[model samples]
Target: MRSERPFSVFVDEFDAFASPAFATFLNKGRSSDFMIHLAHQTLSDLNRVSPDFMGQIMGNMNVRYIFRQDSQPDLGKPAKTR
Candidate 1:
């Protein structure tokens, strides 16, 4: 059973708010009609949180939209960060 009205959560500067528990929810929330929209300036934002955080997000997200950036690294390729 599910609610007729779906629920949605949008977080700006998601890197500041990311957590392992939340990342887990991203995988399980779909069945309950939960939707999440996250925004961040760069992948580095994720790297600052955890080494594998970026991969966790990119893997779960259904769609991605990248805006114009000063340095556009090849998103298809993995890049190391300090």
Candidate 2:
């Protein structure tokens, strides 16, 4: 069965953390498809969120690979490190 509690929490937190453009992008998609799309987009651009928050989101999703700098040289090095 689906858990509304976690999903609700996710929506609230997402709205708080995501940019207006990113949120708009997510809302335009189908609900069933949005999470998958969001996950993909988020993985592709982890810098969109704070590292601590990103870690929390990934942990909640049990995500293994949220796109890495090693995978995409175009993203450049970690901002904080520079």
Query: Which candidate ranks first by TM-score, i.e. highest?
Result: 1
- Write candidate 2's Cα lDDT for 13-81 as tens digits: 343456545544444433433342233333435445544444433433422343544546434333322
Candidate 2 lDDT for residue 25: 44
Each prediction's whole-model lDDT (CA): 0.75, 0.40
Please provide, for model 1 over 15-64, each residue's C-alpha lDDT reduced to its tens digit, 9 standing for 90 to 100. 88888777888888788787989998877777666778777877787767
The clash numbers for all candidates, in the given order, read 0, 0
Clash pairs detected, candidate 1? none
Question: RMSD of model 1, in Å?
Answer: 4.3
